[model samples]
Target: MSGSDETSQARALGEALATLRRERGLSQAEAGARIGMTSQGWGLYEAGKRSNLFRPDVQRRLTGALDATPEALVLQMGGEPASPEALPATGLSARGRVFDGAPLQTRRLRLETDELAPWASAGTVLEYVPGRWPRRGQGCVIQIDDGAQRVRLYDRADDAEVVVLGAGGLDRTERIARSRIQSMSAVTARFDDE
Candidate 1:
């Protein structure tokens, strides 16, 4: 394959692997350990920073770690299937979006109200989006205070939709109707954390 094809295939494989790890609720560090790699190294691999996807050993390790047959992962990574049996259905649609930006900016935020119980606690990591605000229930990482604060915002997509922020506990939920929202941004893609 050409260099471009190789790069594309590598990226696709990297994304697939990352998605699988997230769906399994394994952290990058944990997945790395399973594959005999350090957490940091696994992060790079998931980010497609390494260019050795074609290596036999790497392929073997990945298959073993993901509990998938080599042929299944390989075909999903852009290789043609040798036979119908070689391809296993992963059940995920190929139409999902991928996050292609740098690590999202995060900020400390407090719940502005009681409606967002157990979701957004004060001083939690709020992922931010600079200039784009999402519709209700769209699932966005919002950036406030000029990229200083970031948090995941659950969009309701209604004119009066409220935003939920925070991850742990039941006292962190906050609601901000669309009319009350000052500004926002949409989270186009994310690394699924299962």
Candidate 2:
């Protein structure tokens, strides 16, 4: 091997952290102080001159001090960061990781039954946005009593209740009391196997 993976990761994280600190207009002393470290200590990490900088706790503490986040450094370390537009307005959020190594911005649900057929069939993967409300006539995932959620079309929703329709037709629908809904999300995309 050319070099240890841990060594390479440390160097990359250090460079990224340094860039992040500079972008925030903070000297190493100020940044370190916020995270309860010394200028020389922080500099070691920034210069890839220290090892503990790569630890998870250190990453969290240091990044938090810089008024940025580990996710920013994650991207800087050459890992993909989900698009800002796909993220929550005021908090950290990510759907999950995919095996193909591409960044994904939406939550996924696998269909187990053809009950919602035509719109989505069994084994189909549905992608949706958490904390997002569906537009009129859009598709969405509706949770029923904390069980596996179901994917259905948006019929209508009001403060007291939400009405979701299955693909069987407009005539087929279930009205869920707002209180009964464990959670709900807006379906943004769908995928099917070839």
Candidate 3:
């Protein structure tokens, strides 16, 4: 691993932390509160400002605060960690399509409604991961039992219910019963040209 590798790794970790916090529907203040830290302090970690991100103690506290393990976070961070088992057969696409779980690989979708405008315009593209689950505030493409697919940003997901915020950022939301969903995937990348 070179300096660049380390830098990239830190960046990846920061992004993952931010995503996880959102996925769990916890605000920065909430996550920090769990660990006796301030939101600004937590922001530093999520901004990749701390070079000591891999330090054992730091990793432990952060993961513990999020109710996660180090290995799990690393896997969620994308790319291969020290442990390959973390990510498993799961993967992300980058070159339109790939099986190796390339980081930041983009999967594109075209929207038909301004229902997601300003942030997502009609005919613009949304890129996402087909295998990973969506985070709380991250965009997602979902397939309902009726086989109709739509995109929304997930706000909360539980055993019984899933609440999503969509339409230019939460102007409209859908609270659907989990039983009605046939499939769901995370949105990892986005390409909007509007």
Candidate 4:
């Protein structure tokens, strides 16, 4: 394509990406944070300064971070812009099929150490929902592919890593690579020993 045509197309793509992120109620930083990217890096994509946005892998990575699909982005580019009121307040949508009306998958983990003291001390049994993203400061269980499991407070996550606090105490923090994680679940409840 010609330089001017490429520029125009990039601009259109950037505008669509911006809309998708905004519809999700996320700032550039928040959206970028989900992928371990700097706000300026994300801004470059939105400003049409990044040419890699045209790559399929890049499109998937960026849109997935926004809980969106590249096809949705393209359809959105051709459709009318959404009104502010039309956007969901929380920007989170979940759906599931309940076989025999069964509850969602849940599991319990019993703390064995004071690693996460004050928040979830030893002898605490935690109930967590698999596949659910934890809100900031919430408790979560990180299970690695090698059979290692760690219970920690949720901090933040990016495409590459999950950051959690209180590995050994209230002050410790650990970052685990997403590649090593088998699954992550948000702690829904904690039952303390009597």
On TM-score, the leading prediction is 4
TM-score each candidate. 0.39, 0.43, 0.47, 0.56
What does each candidate score in C-alpha RMSD? Answer: 14.4, 15.8, 9.3, 10.1
| Pairwise TM-score winner, candidates 2 and 3 | 3
Give the count of colliding residue pairs in each prediction.
31, 0, 6, 0
lDDT for predicted candidate 4 compared with the true structure: 0.76
User: How well is each residue in 65-107 modelled by candidate 2, as lDDT tens digits?
Assistant: 7646778776655565557566444322223443243453578
Cα lDDT of model 3 by residue, 1-194, tens digit: 57886677677777888877775556787778767889999998898788777665677688766656665566666533454333223222111222253565547788888776666777877877664566567778888898888788877654466788774455887887778887677776667765
Judging by lDDT against the true structure, name the best candidate: 4
lDDT for 173 in candidate 2 is 85
Q: How do the residues 1-194 of candidate 1 rate in per-residue lDDT, one tens digit apiece?
A: 57786566567777767765664345677567665688889877676678775554675677556545555454554444345443224321122233344665543234343332344333333343443444334435543444333354453332344446543433355665445444555554433222
When summed lDDT is taken over every stretch of 10 residues in candidate 4, the lowest stretch is 90-99
**Higher-TM-score candidate of 2 and 4:** 4
Q: Under the 3 Å rule for N, CA and C atoms, how many clashes does model 3 have?
A: 6
The list of candidate 4 runs beyond 4 A from truth reads: 1-29, 35-59, 66-102
lDDT tens digits by residue: candidate 4, 1-194: 58897788788788889987875546789889888898999999998898887766787788988767766666556743234454334221112232132476789978989988788788999999875556668898878999998888888777778789987786988989988998777888999988
**Clashing residue pairs, backbone N/CA/C < 3 A, model 4:** none
